[model samples]
Target: MNSGEVIDVTRDAIVTFLKVGGPMLVVALLVGVAISLLQALTQIQEQTLVFVPKILALAAAALFAMPFMGDAMASYMTRIAERIAGG
Candidate 1:
């Protein structure tokens, strides 16, 4: 592939990755921030307090978003495969 094709492929891959992971990452970040704020306000300096909520939130987000993520990745892979076959 040429440089332009390579760049397009790279961009598609990155976009696919972000699309797949963004929801869970955002949920985890929000949960972490909220937990941090609560900890600060309550002086509950327990590590698990912060970790557990974030983990749970991320897990829930992952579960909820799994179908969409799978579809996006599958579409991306199909596009990649088609490009390879065409080229």
Candidate 2:
């Protein structure tokens, strides 16, 4: 592939990665921020209090987002394969 094609492929890979992982990360970040606020307000600083909810929220978000992730990966792979075959 030429430089332009290579850059395009790399950009697609990055976008796919962000599309797949971004939601859960965003959810975890939001949860952590909210938890921090709660801890500050209530003065409860147990580490598990932060860890467990973040994990649970991330898991739930990932589970909910799995279909979209799969679709995006499949779409990217198909485009890549087509480019390879054509080139």
Candidate 3:
């Protein structure tokens, strides 16, 4: 409830967010970079070429990462609820 508590909660929220979302983000970034490199090498400048692969990769990543993401979010929520109850 105080400034320190608020800072701690905010910091935890950010860490939880990164933990839950980092995999998909990294997947997206890597896919995008790879696609860009392939396009550069092949001289394929089609702007729409990146979408399908990135989408598929991100979907697969999300699917594989779902359980970990869920556990992280659940833990974060539990901690927040405990703090609230304690206060």
Candidate 2 TM-score to native: 0.94
TM for every model, in the order presented, reads: 0.94, 0.94, 0.98
* Candidate 1 local lDDT, 6-68, one digit each (tens): 999999999999999888888988888898999899999998878777777888888899999
Where does candidate 2 stray beyond 4 Å? none
Ranking by TM-score: 3, 1, 2
Each model's RMSD to truth, in Å?
A: 0.9, 0.9, 0.5
Q: Which pairs in model 2 have colliding backbones? A: none
| lDDT string, candidate 3, 1-87, tens digits | 799999999999999999998999999999999999999999999999999999999999989999999999999999999999999
Highest lDDT: give the candidate number.
Answer: 3
RMSD of 1: 0.9
10 residues in a row with least lDDT, candidate 2: 45-54
lDDT by residue (tens digit), candidate 2, 53-84 = 89889889988999999999999999999999
Collision count for each candidate, in order: 0, 0, 0
> Comparing 1 and 3 by lDDT, which wins?
3
* Model 3 bad stretches (over 4 Å): none
